[model samples]
Target: MAGQTFDLTDDNKILSLRSPKASISGPYKVVFKNIEERWAIVAIDWDGEPRLAIRWFWGNGGNPFSSGNPTWLVIPSSLSNATLNGLPLDFKLYSKLVDFLAGKITGDQIYI
Candidate 1:
């Protein structure tokens, strides 16, 4: 493939959903990965899709789920609290995002 390559750069935390779930979806799966540790799932998106963003987090007393540093809740860099470190994943988002996309909800600039 002449034009096949990998790219990972975005400002919005969007988790593109997939079937069979993934590292950040389902009832039990490692949402966070590190050199030695892996965390379990803490939530699921609407429409039942898998989260694709993998968090490389080493666990000791805390987990990614509890830390709440989600890469799936984008609200625009101009208004986000973690603008510098908001690693938007282009993956799934909170169920609210689904509603927002379907016109079932409304907001300023939140996305998934």
Candidate 2:
């Protein structure tokens, strides 16, 4: 959880962290699946591979930035379409996923 910062810049939007033990060197693409509950997913490139850093279900009581709780769900690039926590990444999830990857949204904020 050390050396982590939220990036909300004009040209870049990501949550980055610099830590030796970090799963991925983030400049991660973040997506919010259930905004009301603050459930989100982050896509990160780790060692030349794509992985999902996700929190399947989180509410106001949960904090995504924390190193503890709501741990990252690392999905291999090949298994991206596979069920995560028994649920498939459907169209709605795909829409939000694309938006986040495209930098159209940052965190829970939607660009106007």
Score each candidate by Cα lDDT.
0.29, 0.45
Using TM-score as the measure, the top candidate is 2
Q: Model 2: residues >4 Å from true position, as ranges?
A: 1-21, 56-71, 82-112
The digit string of per-residue lDDT tens for model 2 on 15-84 reads 5332223555553555334445444556664553445565433333234435453345555655654534
User: RMSDs, each prediction?
Assistant: 12.6, 8.6
TM-score against native, each model: 0.19, 0.41
Candidate 1: pairs in clash: 14-90, 14-91, 14-112, 15-91, 15-92, 16-90, 16-91, 16-92
Error of 1 at 41 (Å): 11
Q: What is the lDDT of candidate 2?
A: 0.45
**Which regions of candidate 1 fall more than 4 Å away from where they truly are?**
1-47, 67-112
